[model samples]
Each structure stands twice: as C-alpha cells, then as structure tokens.
Target: MGEQVSKQATIVGMLWTGGTPKAKEVEENMASYFNVLQGFLLYFYGSTVGAGPTLSSNLHQSVMQVVNSSFNLMKDSVSSYGSRSKDQKVAVPVLVGKVWEACSGLKKAPATNIAAIGRAMTQVAVSMKDVLREMRELKPDSGGQEDDQQTSGGVAGDGDGNEDDDDDVGDMGNDLSPEEMKVAELAMEVVSDLLLVIKELIRSITGLLKMEKADTSGSFVDSLEKLLKSSQVIGAQIDELGACLYPPQEVSTMEAALKKISSSLNGIESEVEDLKGSTDTFVKACSGLRGSIKQLELVLSCCSVGQLEEQLTNTSLSH
Candidate 1:
C-alpha cells in the first residue's frame, strides 16, 4: 500500500510541474503526505479486532481523533485555496478524494460488522458537521443558496442551479445558514443512501437471529418497518424543501411524496404497538394454560386415592 501510494504521489508530482520541483511543489507534497497519514491512521485504528476495554472500544474516539487532525489540516489548505479563481476548483476534487480515501480506510474493518457500519456512519456525520461549520464561519447567516430547479435536460427541479440539496431530517444544531442548509441537504442524500445500507444490515441481522433461534418474535420486524418509513419521511421532506428552496416548479410531486412517507411511518408505528399488545396477550394465555394443567393434576391424584380407599374397605369386608 505504501509503495502504491508513493507511486501515485510521484505521478501527481510529475503532473503538477514539468520537471524541476520548486517551493510551490511543497503544497502538493504536503497534501499527499496528509492524505497518506490519514489513511494509515484509520487503517491501524480499524484493524484491532478484539472486544472489551483492551484495544477494542468503539472506533468513535480513535477515528474522531483522526478526523479532528485531518479537519485541521484541510481547513488550513482550503483557506489557502480560497483566494484562487473559480476555474482553479480542480484542487477541490483532490481534497475531497483525499478526505474520502482516509474515510474508506476505515472500510471493511474488523471487530463487529455492526460497529464497522456505525463507524462509517459516524465518519460521514462528522464530515457533514465540519462542512456545515465551515459554511457558517464563511457566510454567517446567509439564508442559503436556492435549490436546483431543472436538470440539464430541462426536467423541473432536476438540479441545474447552484442550490444546495440535502435530504437530512435530523436536527443540524439549528441556526442553519444557506450554506449550512445546503450541507444539510447533502447530508440527507447521504442518509438516504445510508438507509438502504441499513436495510441490508437489518436483513443480515434478521437472518442471523433466525439462525441462532433468537426470538425476533418481538416487535423487531415492525420496528424495522417503522424505521424505514421514518427514513423515507425524512428523505421526502428534504426533497420537498429543496424543491421549494430551489427553482423550477411542480410542488405537487414533492408534496405527495412527503404525504405518502408520513402516512407510512404513522401506519408502521401503530402496527408495532399492536404487535406488542399481541405478544403480551400470548404470554398471558400460555401462563394461564400452565396453571390449569397443574390444578388438573392435583384433582386426578385426589380421585385416585378415594377409589383406592373404597377398594381396600370392600376387600376387608369380604375377608
């Protein structure tokens, strides 16, 4: 991995300048170094595959430490790049890729799959939060940019404009600036994707439960449905808000989507509650049946003793 990374670095170096590296070459070198360091850190941190308080606490703390350091480095670099022309946005892609590459190092991590997923989710969340923070510092309360009103092909609200699109429904610490709102919208999109991932996780876990004969006979199935519905509700809201905030028309579509998701979530919540009630009733019925069986055994014992006594008395009389 180190050799491959070094080769990529050499290629990048070659592309940056014709041949002779100068003072400006230091910037590229610095970026590459940071990128490699971040990936290495995540790789090492995520590799530990034990449990208990030893080296296998949740990856949150260790990964977070990497994130904090990475963010600081990126902040300085982005600040330095801010003065460049819009055409110079080529640097943005490299930075974005580096950040994600670092994050991807935490991928396929050991320990537990659930924990791995959680770590991935946390990484995305922290990245979004940092972006929002940067936006706040830049624009203060700049309402937010409008949403995309049309796609390149002319579909309404298809995302042509420079509007920020997000699908996140959870609290973004309030006081959202336009840029922050945009970040929030992107976060929502990330969440929408994450929901699909989570659904897959649930399916895997459910199968595990069945294999272990672990009674998922609880409200688990219904609860899962409810969660999926809620996620849909949130995604729909972000789309609706984005359409409103952006350009192009067709509010009806967004509105209908929101309504459908909301209704589904409400329905699922009700079903989950009913499932709980049913399980409770089934447990009570089993208990009652058990008690009746014990009582019937007692009655049968007494009847047998009475018949035996009568037989003994008759035998004595005959003798």
Candidate 2:
C-alpha cells in the first residue's frame, strides 16, 4: 500500500512539473494537481493514526514538494503569458489562487507533527505572495504606439475581407492594456495576500495547539491568548484585503458579500474571547476544589470512624 501511494504521488509530481502550456491548459493542469493533493490529504487523514511518525512526515514532505513545484510552474506560466489576451492572462493567477485555497485542508489532518506541515504551508503562502508582487511589478506601461498599431491593424484586417483570418489576428492582438493589467495585478495581489494571512493564522493556531498539548505549567495559556488576539488582527486584515479586491463603487454585490464575511469573522472572534474567559474560570474553579479536597482529607485523617460519624451527624443537625 505504501509503495502504491508513493508511486501515485510521484506521478502527480510529474504532472505538476510538466512544461508550461497555454492559459487554458495551465488551468486544467492545476485542477488535476490539486485533485491529487486532495487525495493525498484524505489518505493521510485516514492513515495517520496507524502510520509511523517518520512515514507521515515523509509523505507530508513529498506533498509539499509537489505543491512548491506546482506554484513555480504557475509563476512561469503567468510570466510567459503576461502579454496574452486579458482573459487568459487573468485566468492563470486566479487558478493558482484557487489551488492554494484548496490546500487549506492540510492543517486539519490528524498527524503527530502538524507544526511541520504548518511551516511548509507558510512557505507556500510566501511563495504565492511573491508571485503576486511579481505580477504587479510586471504590469505594462501605457503605449500610444501600441494603440496606433492596433487601430491600423484592425483596418488592414478588414480590408483583407477574410473574417476567420481577422478573428485570429484580433485574438493574438487582444493582450491587456497597461491600465487593465494594473487592475488585474492589484486584484490578484489582494487575493494572494488574503490567502497568505489565512495561512499564517493557521500556522499560529497549530503552534498554539502544540504548545497547549505539551504544557504542564500552564505556560501555553499566554501564547493561546496572544494567538486569539492575532486571529482578530488577521481577520481585520482579511476584511481590508477583501475591500481592496472588490470596491464598493464597482462591485456592490461582492461588497455586500464581503461585509457578511467580515461580520461572521467578528462573531467568531467574540466567541474565541468568551471561550478564553470560560477556560480561565474553569481552571480556577478546579484549582479551588482541589485545594478544599486536600484540606478535608487532612482533617479526616485524624478522626476514627465513630468520631467521623458523630461529626457528620452534628453537622447535619446544625445545617
């Protein structure tokens, strides 16, 4: 079974590293790649309890390798097709973002060393952010000459009177204008940053859980409190990122949807705060009960059975 799993993982890795294709092909490849990732994630979830830690760790590393390779392949495709038609150019990065989103389930796998997985995911997020920044930087400048050429080319194509040929030429020349590319790049950056913040939040929460499990002196509580605070901050960041992606003037529906999400996040934050307070109260109550029990045990140790029976009867009468 292990051998078969390894073989399957190897095949998927190959598909990710497959040479750059056109925009549509890139999207298809990414979909297949993420499907394989999802499969491995589910396999790990089912097998983690019985699997050795070393084996699970190795499997995780292999999956991350594929993820990183896929990310790089996406970056290359985006750069290569940056001058392609607006739809094609935009599709590559959007697909990449979706692939990252799909992998968000990795943190939930029941593994012994989730910290390692979280670190790997953080690296992937960082890579994605870098790619977005690169895309923004690659946004082309305004070109009066290019526009003039397009106008002349349109007239020339019409004169040829072959509609099919004209269509082909038009498609080739439909590359995004500078302003449009800038908008697309900015949108992609916001999406990528949102994903990054979410990944970081996941990593921090995983770390917090590990600390809590290993704690004996309640040191983890402070870290847990800090993590909750950080979660609130990240939630706010997500709201800002959403606003950047969907401005109120241009996409009112999206803006309304984002507002709903922001509200939900706020609700979650309040719940986390309430949970923290409840936990502290429970711990203090347990401590007090333990101390009272210890005192009662000391007092009872000095009494014989007859004396204890008399004391109990007197106390009941007084009550």
Candidate 3:
C-alpha cells in the first residue's frame, strides 16, 4: 500500500509541475491516484482497528500526507493551466470531483484515524476554494486587439443611433460561456460536498472521544486535542469558502449552508471544551451528537443542490 501511494503521489507531483500535459494524461493520473487512495482507505478501515497504536498512528500520518500532496497537485494544475486550452482548464474541476469521490470513502475510515482524515480533507477543501475563485474570474477570449478596436469603433460611431443594441451585445460578450459556467458549478459542488465530509468526520471523532472506553488512557485525550485542532482548521476553511469571489447574491445559499455548518462545529468545540474528566456526561452528549450532525449534513446537501439548480436555471435563461 505504501509503495502504491508513493508512486501515485509521484505521478501527481510530476503532472502538477511538468508543463501542461494532455487532458487525457491528466485524467488518467487523477484516476490512478483515486484508485490508490481508495485502496489505502479500505485497508485502513478494515485493519487499522486491530493494529497497535504506533502502527495505526504511522499509517494515519502516511495516508494524510499522501491525500494532502494529491490535493495540492490538483490546485497547482488549476493555476498552471491558466493560459492553456479550455480542455485543460476544465480537467482540473473534473479531477477535483474525483478527489471528492475518493474522500467520501473516508466515512468508513477507522475511528482512530478520523481526525487525520479530517485535516487532510480540510487542506483539499481550501485548495478547491482557491480553484473556484479562479474559475469565477475566467473571462472568454475577446479575440484580440483588432476585435477590441472594432468593438470600440462600432460603439463610438453608434452614439445614440444604436446605443441600446451595442449595450446588449457587450453584455452578451461578458457573460460566461456555458462550459465556463459548468466548470464553476462543478467546483462549487465539489467544495460543498467536501465540507459535508469534513463535518461528518469531525462529528464521528467527537463521538468516539466521548466514549467511556475511549477515556481509559491518555490516547483519548490526545485524540480529542487533535480533533479540536482539526475542527479549528475546518472552521477557517469554511469561512474562506463562504467568502468566495462570487457575488453575494450568487452564493447566498451556499454561504447560509456554510454558516450552519460553522455553528455546528462551534457547538462541537464547546462540547469538547466542557469535558470535565467525566465519562457519564460525555456519553450522554454523544447519544444526540451524531443525529445533529446528520441533520446538518442533510441540510447542507439540499442547499448545495438547490444552489446549483438555480445557477443552471440562470445560465440557461441568459442563453
């Protein structure tokens, strides 16, 4: 598993730094990386529970490093392809979707490793947010200087004769192409899905931390601290996503969903903070915590789908 992960990471790094590869090549590398990630996640889920603490910890760290590197490579690809063809530009969001698919498998990751997985997912979410911002800024090529000159000359000559017609044409030109809008929508959906995953993982770790058996040793306390730190990182990532470059009107639904997730995370943080070395109180709280998280995840999922549908409707209407 380690060898496979190393090889996959190397492929992603090469693709990221190496000059623009063919879209097919990028897709293949992303698929390969996803395969390796799935294998690692399955192994961790099936066997990590029985492994000793040292071994489990090592495995968790190794997997987290690989996930972080892979997502960084995806982000680099998005930035690196800024001047490339549309195909290459679109490939990044597709790769991001694949990464999200891989991350969804982490719901089955070992309880002990949930914190590490959450941290890695947070890194990926942050990078995706950056890519989404870049995508939103994309403007279709307006031909060249000649085209600009022609447009300006036409507008100048029109004066009051055809001013409204020129204004409508200009508006049409500035509107995002269908493909570009699709890419933006894809990026937003992937970011939203990742947030859901992070929320669930944190909630899972919190529940485990509050278990009676979990407090038998110092390890539980250590895990709780790690969860707290990871939660903070996720909270910051959520804030960044909420502050995306899109106009507030466009992202209002997403922002509202993020705000709800942020509140849930804060509540979890408070629960962790109020731990007074008592197992009974922790157990009582754990009973309802998972349910609350599930409710939030459902709400987030619905909001994301609605936002995407609304965007699609607007895009179609503009066309």
TM-score, cand. 1: 0.24
* Model 2: per-residue Cα lDDT over 1-319, one tens digit each: 2233334334433443444445676567557555665676677567654333433765566556546645654564546553545554445454444444434434444444335434444544565465455444443434588567667877888755344566647445334443334344544544453453445445344534544456566444433434334444434533443333321112333344334434444443443344343244333433443343333233334553345557767988999
Higher-TM-score candidate of 1 and 3: 3
Off by over 4 Å in 2: 1-145, 151-189, 210-250, 264-319
The digit string of per-residue lDDT tens for model 3 on 1-319 reads 6456655655665565556677788778778877887887797667665344433665676567557756765665756554656666556545544445445444544455434444554565566566556655655444466467767878888765354676657555444434334434554554555445445544555455345345455555454555545555555544554344233223444445455555655555454555443254444444444444455445445555356557778988999
Query: Alpha carbon lDDT of residue 18, candidate 2?
Result: 41
The better candidate by lDDT, 1 or 3, is 3
TM-scores for every candidate against the unseen true structure: 0.24, 0.30, 0.28
Q: How many angstroms is residue 57 displaced in model 1 relative to the true structure, after the best TM-score fit?
A: 23
Clashes of 1: 10
Error of 1 at 270 (Å): 3.2
Q: Using TM-score, rank the candidates from best to worst.
A: 2, 3, 1
Cα lDDT for residue 76, candidate 1: 40
- The global C-alpha lDDT for each of the candidates, from Candidate 1 onward, is 0.42, 0.46, 0.54
Per-candidate Cα RMSD to the true structure, in Å, reads 26.1, 27.1, 18.4
**Superposition TM-score, candidate 3 onto the true structure:** 0.28
lDDT ranking, high to low: 3, 2, 1
Which candidate number maximizes lDDT?
Answer: 3
